[model samples]
Target: MKRAYGLGTRSVAVLLLSVSLAGCGLPRSGPSKSEILAGSVEKLGTTYIVPVDARVARAASKSPELGFSADFVTADVVGSDVIHPGDTLSLVIWENVDDGLLASKGVNATELQELQVDDAGFIFVPYAGRIRASGNTPETLRQAITDKLKEQTPDPQVLVSRAAGDGATVSVLGNTGAQGVFPIERPTRTLSSMLARAGGIAVDPETAQITVTRRGRTGSVWLKDLYRNPRMDIALRGGDVILVEKDTRTFTALGATGGQTRVDFDSPNMTAIEAIAKVGGLNTNLADPKGVFIMRDETPEIASAVLGQAGLRETQRVAYVLDLTQPDGIFNARDFIIRDGDTIYVTEAPYVQWQKTLSVLTGTASSANAITNAAGG
Candidate 1:
């Protein structure tokens, strides 16, 4: 019966090993590469898996981002002497006679400093009836004042200049070297000049966004684009609000990468290779070089172009595959762009699971050996 007893003991040991492995649960970060492929079958899962190539990279790189529209880019440049209500004006008046009605006492020229424009756009000048100043340039206002005063004094000379006032100023705020209300002066009439006058953007130029809000409409563009594309520097108007802020675009890293977290875009036009490096590369011990995937929700047009198909009616779920083991894999990844809201996942190597299985088997065998030794003793 010794032979029968030995077989029974071996059967028990095998049963225990099976139970132990089942209890361990495999301990995985995410689904394996095989599982991902199997899950993508028709009617089984929703993710459309597409391998990354030069063509796909080109198609996916055209992502929509924040930028100014034609309305903002085509707006005319503001003139320094443009008048507005609440604006301050300085005026000088002269007459053929030594002392005129608007002239200073004992002075041939009358100096009117800090003349405020009323809400109705009118400014009252001594001996010159109230005149509309808003919607007119300093020269135009000068002519109006001259015509009005000429009836009272012959050969009247009038000069009008805009002074620093609550009107015709831009509120510069957020991530700027200096944040406050900046006047729209001669050098600070356009967007670029106004930003410079506010001490420029305090954030990185690559991630900085310059936003302008005018009459309830808003437009934004990268700070670098402002300098590169001159058309983006539109004129600033009175009561216009300007904001400089860091980019809020981000992508998530999951699975076997260095850190499973959301990472912000630190540069413009981020690529898959740059994203990998930003997340601390990959976990060398667990990462599968051939299973790097970037998942994104692409529009129907872009999806059709990437898949070489047409008539995609809705937003398509796309998983872009990358195999770093191939000769051109690194190059392919370098060219593949990573957009905001994408998820990067690197599967664990297959052998890593096998290693765990072997460890479990060896540990069980060692436990059996110890039991046998104890029984013999």
Candidate 2:
């Protein structure tokens, strides 16, 4: 009887120990507030935490300009119909003399259908050896050719016109109606006009991202912004590459929200409340309305503006907290804007942890009673 009693007590002790150990490793939606503040130090590319308020929301609301600069917007459009190398010129040469240098049988004029301008910007004629036609306009090239032929054939008249040729053009690619090279004509000289000529953006205009690359530099703007801001309708240059694509900016939803996902921007701008709705709102059964958090790496300028303190480090780590339980919490959230790459987190209710502990303890007690009975039997 003494041995049996001892076995029962030992079993009870072991059962209690097991329950305590399991409680330590209880499964959770995410880290608690205290855990985030303590363990997040020097971890997961985050190092600082800051609570958000109305003032911080206003100061940090200013987003970076994502459109054309003064240099691009203020630039004057290039001359229309500028000649370039490898252009095709059609010329009709006429002479008063019946049997002229460029005339045909019983005709006072002759036609040259395709005169391909060489890589060296020179075109060869019947009598005029070779004349540069690259940089000259139709009128100037006609005058130059007339001068060349008038020396041999008296009083020559020439008419010059451009045909389909490899001239000033831009390449439109990626998520556009027509992905090909389009010449920069009078109708398609600006960024907006060129996009229209290419059948506009294939993706939704609200989430469309247009990138223009000229020379070696690149600039980008949202399609909505391009139409809203006239300054963003920059001039297109020769050999510029325009890429229309869907917006890739997204924010991560984690913790006790309805779902955890990396959601793309569906509109030009998204507020914090909209972001919450986007992730299917919080899990009311498990969420702490006061523990909502948004984490991001802010620029030094924005960080100073938000904290009203200068001389901060480059890209300061920040955490904006929102308490939906407050009368004005929802309003503050509505005012707060969600920037790119922000990670939103919601903490679980404190009582949820207590419930897990009690559950483990109840199971342990039942197991202990069974062990005691077995020992006695």
Q: For model 2, how does the per-residue alpha-carbon lDDT over 104-128 read when each residue is reduced to its tens digit?
A: 7689999998899989989998889
For model 1, which pairs clash? Answer: none
Estimate the lDDT of model 1: 0.86
Clashes of each: 0, 0
lDDT of each: 0.86, 0.85
- The true-versus-predicted C-alpha distance at residue 257 of model 2, in Å, is 1.1
Scanning candidate 1 in windows of ten residues, the lowest lDDT window is 15-24
Against the true structure, candidate 1 reaches a TM-score of 0.90
List, residue by residue over 1-377, the lDDT tens digit for candidate 1: 67656755975677586656743477888988888877672547887888887777888888777678787777787788889899999998888887668665677788899999999999999887799999899999999999998888889888888885667888999999899998899999899888889898899888998889988999998888888888888878788999989999999999999999999999878999999999989899999999999989999999989887899989988888999988889998999888989999999999998887777767666776666555555
Q: Give the total clashing residue pairs for model 1.
A: 0
Off by over 4 Å in 2: 1-8, 11-15, 39-46, 94-100, 107-109, 118-122, 127-132, 139-159, 164-167, 373-377
